[model samples]
Target: MKRFKHLLPVLLLLMSLTAAIISCKKGGDDPTPTPTPAQPVTTITSISPATAPVGSTIAIGGTNFGTSPTSNTVTIGGVVATIVSVTDTQIVVVVPTGAANGPVSVTAGGQTAQSQSTFTVYVAPLKPVVEISGTTFANQNWTRDKIYLLKGLVYIPADFTLTIEAGTVIKGAAPDQDPDKKNMAGTLIIERRAKIIAQGTASQPIVFTSAKAAGQRAYGDWGGLVLIGKAAMNTTSTAALPGGVRGTVERYAEFNDNSGTLRYVRIEYAGAAQPTGSATRLSGLSLYGVGNSTVIDHVQVSYSGSDSFAWFGGTANLKNLVAYRSFDDDWSADWGYVGNVQFGVAVRDPDVADQSGSNGLELENYDPTATTDVTPVVLANGLQQTAPVFANLSSFGFGTTPTTNKSAKGTGAYLAGLYLRRNAAVAVYNSLLYGYPEGVSLGATGATPGVTNNTIDLQGIVLANVLTPVVGNGVLTSDLTTTYFTTSGRANQIVQSSDLTALRLNNFNATTPGFLPQSGSSLLTGAVTGGKLANSFFTPTTFRGAFGTDDWTTGWTNFFPQNTDYDR
Candidate 1:
């Protein structure tokens, strides 16, 4: 009976265990189920030729490319991309044609791969090459599709010739704000030993002017025309041709006897400034220490703010130079310019001028310590004077600068007709000095040495309505010359006192005509050159005054006069 009881207990235990196992099995068999394989995601990875040409073939890379996308498809920009070929993990697409040289992108299966906006198609510019050989301009037809740039001190190779077609405009560049960088506008530096055969006739004369429009034109609009030659000039340095060529400013080593020729050419406003403190200020034409081998004839410099022509101590010969309405001194040569000039004229503006405005010529030696080697700048057959004497000198007297002394006169040394100071020794003859506050004042600074051996042989010279006598210590005149201290030619005259505190003179207006030499204006006939009169002064036969002849009035006009203010 006990064994039977133990067996029953065992059976009950076994049945309970079985019931627990069944419960666990029932819980495991609930409604939850595992998922089947999912559809793969589509995406774009990369593009080739990060920067490709417009017509180049490009490739696109990506994964899970669809055959016919319903909501998302591969595209570039907004245009749907044509899938040349597609695989399970990649898609090949050709770049679109006629695409701009800008950024490109690839979009596939709602994913995008982009190239930045700065990225562009690569295309090289076709540069026009110029090859000069055998001392002659060989590439005559090279400028067809090219622009010329005279970069970084270009040496006009010796025995090399540069011939440009008519009506060609060349711009200059110089580092203004930054000399180290490309700050300079442009510059054409004609170095020593280099010859340029730039010839222009009167009928079809060559023009060198600013690129700006007439109304907006200005002086120093661009860099100046720097001609470096081995010439003689009046300067303090014992060495000839003081300022050297290019960056080397020294005495001339070998005197170049080949005089550069410039005829029937008109250079408009030029004279762009270079680096700060640079001696260059953009004179219409800058002759840096050239020699007598240079010839400047039949050239017109109009509306230039600076001196029309600046010679830095060179022995160049000038014939028929016209200075029409230059703001500063008409002709400036210093540092030993021992050159000879004939048939030169200076014209002044009644208005639209500055205190620095001068009628005839100015010469000087900026250096105070250099040894003296004086060479006289000779001038003949010219009318060197201010316009007409305005009764009210207020309008014409140094027009603007209150501090400027209109009554001052000298060889540019003091202030007037022939100002020769800073030890500058110059000689002048057969020129008229009229309508000046002071005829001639010499030795500006008490310490500054006066002009030595300088002669002014004024034959039939007219001195009309001047503040002071034409015969100053600086002016050495003979009996043949007439000096009228108190005289009047064209009315409306004014005079200032020595105190220089008040303005004096009479009704000077815009309409007041300066000295206008008539066609038969006595000055037309009597010009004794070397000794014999030349038929061509500026045009046909020596005419009169500074601009003895007129080329524009005859058949041409519309010369782009330079602006008085080059910087503005």
Candidate 2:
């Protein structure tokens, strides 16, 4: 039919070119496949506080968290926190000072997300509640899981240091009963060249109580620990320390002034009384003029109303001292304290006294009619006149009788058990004055020319159950115990407390007693052995007085400071 009309226009142009190649492959193939973005899954699912503390601020929540907090990150416990605010379902960070306890990831876009459990980072068994006060001078540490909080006269001034780490606990406050605010006492003053590392061990010590609250605490309730150094003093000129109480004068630091370390410390229920004069108090450690590189070992001044480790002038050389239950004077030195103590331990509580008479070592010098006159201040300060060289002392009093009826005329008016008097120049070795009424008083009745020119050295002492073992005001009577057992060099006993019941102490009026010393004890063989304490700050212990068969005041001494729990 003539090729069927030429193939009917070529079959209609090949079916219109196959319908234009199927309409250009159904409208240009595959250039629109770019809608697949949904991979940003950074989930965390709730993290409000699962513990949080290292500078707290948690709150993580859930989901993507990547609307763009710079595409988010977070970490925590792997540390990197500090992200403040992020969105896409919340983020808020900051728990990174050393963020410890684990998993809290949360990446974003790159997709990370951890938190399902394990966050727990609030480790402060005490920290936070820092407070302090005034003058500092930078470098101040205090960490052992902090408690700090002094709040009044906290000064450190003159080239500061103040470290304090080993299990610290500070606390102070309370005591503004407004006697014009009583100098606002909460004291910590270190002044002078200021320094106080406060090392502590014997199982973590460093405490300092009185934020009152634990049997409502007592005794002055705060304001104590004052250091103030410059080494030499015998009144006059360094503003005559003592009642003039000058601490921050700003110079003088010699006698080996390194003013730092104080190992295994504990000073509970501090002093606080000095608002103005009279028996001017403030002590449980007030070492003005501290030096000799200042270390002071294993200290513990408990329940002191005043004077329990005082030293208006210092050469600073204490060692394992522990004066518990002191109202006043359990080791007090004055105007010219040339230090060197060793293993001291005083325990007294016949219902506390302190009308200027509580004694167990209350030395003094520099006041031959003061206004600065101790012979031109010891001939223009070559110093060394308030002597202070006790060794291995262990004084425990209150036992003439009365377990608690109290007043044996106010405990025989200030229970003297080693009082040494105003023109003092002491040195007692291997001591152990027990259960006293009076056992070693000397001069002080108008001082008697400083008891005929100072020098009261007693050796290897052991006056027990003393009613009056050596009194001397009409100038050293009983011939000063026959000149302290024939010229102060050999043994010197006066036993009677039931011939010294092996001194297993345990109840010198309880409250954690147990001043050790029992297995065949004659104080473990009358100490003072051959090499007589071979110097180098004497540590030669054949056993005598201040405990010797272990028990260096056991696990950081805190004889139930009114049931301790200074915020745990």
> Which candidate number maximizes lDDT?
2
RMSD of 1: 22.0
- Count steric clashes of candidate 2: 0
**Candidate 1's error at 413, in angstroms?**
15
Give the TM-score comparing model 2 with the true structure, all chains together.
0.31
Residue lDDT tens for model 1, 1-568: 9989879989999999999999989898686778887755554556665566543455555556555434234445444545566665555555454445544454445655554443345554644433221123332322223334333223454445455443344433333422336455344456666665556565545555554544776656655556777553333334332212244454453344553566666666665555434344557777776666666666777666567788776656676566655656667766555556665655455343435546456666645543442232332111111110100000122332222243332113113554444544444433544445544444323322232222222222333344553434323232112222222221111223342222212232332323335444544444323321231322233432333434333321123343321111
For model 2, residues 534-553, the per-residue Cα lDDT tens digits are 55787777666777676678
Q: For model 2, what is the alpha-carbon lDDT of residue 379?
A: 23
Global lDDT scores for all candidate models: 0.46, 0.73
lDDT of 1: 0.46
Candidate 1 residues lying further than 4 Å off, grouped into runs, are: 1-157, 173-182, 232-245, 253-256, 350-359, 365-415, 433-435, 444-460, 469-516, 519-568
Error of 2 at 526 (Å): 42
**What's the CA error at residue 201 for candidate 2, in Å?**
27
